[model samples]
Target: MEVTLLLEATENAFRIMEKARAHALGVLDTAVQFTGEQTRFMEEKRWQVLFAGAQRRKTRFQNFVGTALILFAFWMLLSGHFDPFHLTLGAICCIITAYLFHDLLFANVRVGDMRVVALRFLCYIPWLIQQIVLSNLHVASVVLRRKMPINPQIITFKTKLETDISSITLANSITLTPGTITMDIRDGVYYVHALDQKVADDLNAGEMEDRVAHIFMEADHLYVEDVLDAARIYDALRV
Candidate 1:
């Protein structure tokens, strides 16, 4: 009887120890899983924060470089000095100005490839020149007429352009044309002085505004030419 009681007690103790070990292992596994999830969450958040900061830094750098290049070009154009000493001084001034006012130049700039914008603008120049020539001839004809046909009037229209650069470009283009001058721009509305009723009708046609929007990639509606231009830009970038 004593031997049997001792055997039973030993078996029960062994079973209890086996159950306790399994419970401890279960608790440890749950704790490990929770810790792993927490670590992953923190890592993801850290990566997101780092990526946002990097993007901000990149945009700032781009703005600075763009500003510097424009200022340098303007300096060269206005100074008309090609000597090394003058070039160096101009470059230094441009760099300083860019550093001080980079944000101002790009403050309302849309997010797009500057190269694409430049290429489009270059393409637009020929068309603009043609328009200017046509306008000049028309103006000359009107001025040389016996009646003079001079009915000057101001016309106001709200523009769909989203960025300041596009708006300014459109304004300048109008002023460059012989029959029209951009009097003022306020709250996205342009006030233009037209030399005659024909000029006013042409301004109301909205072709110039559309072209400006296309150059800046700010158009809500894209023409076939605009689509082709965008496709070409994309392919070039991919290469």
Candidate 2:
């Protein structure tokens, strides 16, 4: 009976040991799984941090270069190579070139490509001239006509635009155009006072929006959406 009791005790101890081993193995497995997940998460975060740092450095470099160019241009201007008229022309040309050719210098940020900007300029210059001339003629016709038929109305509308320079350029263009004037602009909504219904409807229809985007070359590189969206304020009184 003692031998039988001893064998039973031995069997119980072995079963207990087996259960303890299983529990230890389960804990170890869970620990290893947790470590692996942490390692992967840490690696991903490190990669993101590295990428962002690189981008910030690149942007700093671009800003340095842009500033240097502006200073150099001013230096040349002061050196007297270009006279007053020539200086004015040169300055305007410099600004246009900088705006249009930024990608040639600053290669990152995926701002709209320089090639697109160039193409747009090709289209935009002639279009601008045509617009200016046509508007001038329209205003002249109205002024010279026997009856001064004028019906000025203020129209407000929202634009789905997300760039600063482009929108401001658009506002200036609208104000510059004869008979039509921009009365107020807040956010992406513009309050334009048009000489007639035709120009008001045209602005609402997105012709002007598309043109502005095209001129800016849709470069997503700059903080264009924020700058462009917020900087536009034009108020021109139509005569």
RMSD of 1: 21.3
In the range 70-144, model 1's lDDT, one tens digit per residue, is 788789899988999999999899889989997897887666677789998999999999999998998889989
Tens digit of lDDT per residue, candidate 2, span 57-160? 55554544464466446767566765687766665666666666655554443365556666776877787788889899988888999987778899887765
Backbone clash total, candidate 2: 10
lDDT of 1: 0.78
Q: How much lDDT does candidate 2 score?
A: 0.64
Report the lDDT of model 2 for residue 124: 77
Cα lDDT listed for each candidate? 0.78, 0.64
Best by TM-score: 1
User: Candidate 1: which stretches are off by over 4 Å?
Assistant: 1-33, 36-47, 69-94, 226-239
* TM-score computed on alpha carbons, candidate 2: 0.58
